[model samples]
Target: MLQIYNTLSRSKQGFKPIEPGKVKMYVCGMTVYDFCHIGHARVMIVFDMVVRWLRTSGYEVLYVRNITDIDDKIINRAIENGEPISVLTNRFIDAMHADSDELGLMHPDQEPRATDYISQMQGMIGTLIENELAYQANDGDVNFAVRLLPRYGQLSDKTLDELNAGERVAVADGKRDPLDFVLWKSAKPEKPAGTLWSSPWGKGRPGWHIECSAMSCDILGEHFDIHGGGADLQFPHHENEIAQSEGALYGKDRKDDDAPFVNYWMHNGHIRVNEEKMSKSLGNFFLIRDVLKSFDPEVLRFFMLKAHYRSPINYSDAQLEEARAGLVRLYTALAQPAPKVLETALDPNNPWAQRFAGAMNDDFNTPEAIAVLFDLASEVNRAQGDEKQLLANLLRSLAATLNFLQREPTEFLQAGAKDQAGLTAELIEERIAARVAAKQAKDFAQADLMRKALLEQGIVLEDKPGGLTEWRRA
Candidate 1:
């Protein structure tokens, strides 16, 4: 049985989906106002690992991640750049896809857009108003009646009496209470082209809370198994979702027929920079692309999993460089030539892979799993005559099952920027020329030196049945 840390229960609960052979998962996605950062990658990669392990253990997982195409941030960014809101969000969405692809996150089974589900959102808002769960003011702005929803503060552990948002109460004719959040914000005359939809209340845009509710219900069903996001979303966002979803279903008088919403909730820890909180005001934020320019994706993954998913990750250049160096050792060990893989499950004469599997099975402890990988590397480097091939094959086969060590051995051994072999054809030609000059001048010493340097850097030279020195990345 697989056990997972459920944030809702705050425990490692056994995973049993409502359906027999399937699992449903929903992850809150990017707002599409800016490039994705390492914090976003933490959530994405953590969930990707979750899905991968579920599939590895024989569960059919239908993963859905939503794109918040419309939000205050998106509109402001549009205005700042002098572009249409649609154009701005689309550009960021494309950037999101590229970054997700680079970081190795699996494409979600469904990616619902907020703009496409405004009708559903409006319908939910109307139900809330009818059931006294919400109310609309004179200005046509609808707000969620927090006091009416008895479980308003349950998810965030806040009390209804002390609901403090640190913002002053505004005098709006439509709102009955101050704690009530806007379910639909009435479009103002000044902002003509931001976004708006016709609802019972008035022409307005859906609030942040309603977007997730409508999108999740529309795609995954009225109820689903898991709802996950960053740790920061536990409060108002998720709290509001639980209220609107369950309240709407109950208000329809389908108490029993109401689909049970997310049975489990999961959240990954935040990413910090050098132990300092990464924020725009602090000027310490780094986009994932900028970080990727200096480091390999796998090294970043290893760095992330080094700490438990629930623990904060402190990012720094030194930490990533160290991870890269350590990763090289393991990948190189697997990248060595593999003999024929044995058909059946046996001891395999190496305990590293078995140790890895056992660690992975125990509550998806990737840190422990990675420790096993390091142990395998230690064993490989220490092994002599009889033990080498068995350990190498074990590492290769295990990595095939778990994608942590997939790169070819040559690629794995590369350490620094210098490890990149021959950046251009001109560099290759120059290196070749140096080698030829050394050999022709009878300075065989220099020629042999250049060849060894190239080989060490992962450039394999072949004196192929052709008279030319053929070269390729190993």
Candidate 2:
């Protein structure tokens, strides 16, 4: 059984879904105003790993990651670029898919876009209003009445008084309370025409918090197995989701018959840059495409899982290089040709497999699980004959759970880094040919010089036994 740390409970707890043998998970996804950054990548990859593990653990998983396509950021970016909102969002949505593909992310079962769920959002807002948990302000904006929900700050572990003292909430125009968040934003005369949707609160769009509440409940019912996002969203975003979702379901007058909104809440830690939070405003954030220019996507993914999901991961060239080397070692073990070992059903009872499961079950402790992989890889390297083949198969089988080490080892090794210093597959091959010619002529000095030159360009050349040489980017 898996024990996940529930953000709401603030402790690790055994995972039990509302339905036996089934899991329905909702994760807050990208707000598509620009290219996804490393932070966004963590969210996508983390949840992907979770879903993979759930299915591997013999449960049917229904994963839904919602896209916030109609947010203020998307609207502003579209206006700035003088394009339609759909045009701006569609471009980034495509970019996001490309990035996810490059990172080897498994697509969620359902990707619900905010624009497509407007009717559901409106209906939920109306329910809140009727329940007196939400009200239309004097300015026509509908806001959640935080004071009415006694457990408003439960998810964040902050009482209303503590939140008020520790953080500053701006008193927006027409809001009854500073802490109250908007459920529906009333349209302004200066706003773009298509940005608004007709609703009981006039022509305006749904607020960010209500979008997830509506979409998750609509798809997964009033309650679900897991709700996850980055730790940054633990405050107002997720806290408000808890308020609205639970408030709508149970109403202001709580009933014993009402079910809890989400059974478990999970959050992955942030990706830091040089020990500081990575952010665009700080000029420290790295775009996924930008990073992929230098490092292999698998290297990036490996770096992410090196640290526990709940722990902060630092991003730097040194860290990525280290991750690259580690990945290369894992691939090197798989490169050796051996007799095919019979594929067998995954046995959790296997000693190494049990260790892997133990680590994974204990709150998805990837670092420890990865250690098990490294240990198995060592056994694969030392053993021979049938024993080695069995170990190799076990290594591959275990790695598949985390979605790693599936590619042919040579393919990964020779794939090299993405375009760097004008190095291309043709250019590297040409250099290799020159080096081979020098060696064939017995011009040892010239051969050594050619090898040195390629090495200087971050390529490592390996001499094989059959007058063959292999090269990979270092």
RMSD of each: 4.7, 2.2
| Segments in model 1 whose C-alpha atoms lie over 4 Å from true places | 167-174, 252-260, 338-354, 383-387, 400-402, 418-474
Candidate maximizing lDDT: 2
Candidate 2, 225-328: lDDT as tens digits:
99999999998899999889888888877665667788899999999999999999899999999999888899898899989999999999999889888888
lDDT score at residue 261, model 1, on the 0-100 scale: 66
lDDT value, residue 123 of candidate 2: 94
The alpha-carbon deviation from the true structure for residue 187 of candidate 1, after best TM-score superposition, in angstroms, is 1.0
lDDT, model 2, position 359: 94
Q: What does candidate 2 score on TM?
A: 0.94
lDDT of 2 at 413: 79
The true-versus-predicted C-alpha distance at residue 407 of model 2, in Å, is 1.0
Question: With candidate 1 superimposed using the best TM-score fit, by how many Å does residue 27's alpha carbon deviate from the native?
Answer: 0.2
Considering only N, C-alpha and C atoms within 3 Å, which residue pairs clash in candidate 1? 137-174, 335-409
Instruction: State model 2's lDDT.
Output: 0.88
lDDT of each: 0.76, 0.88
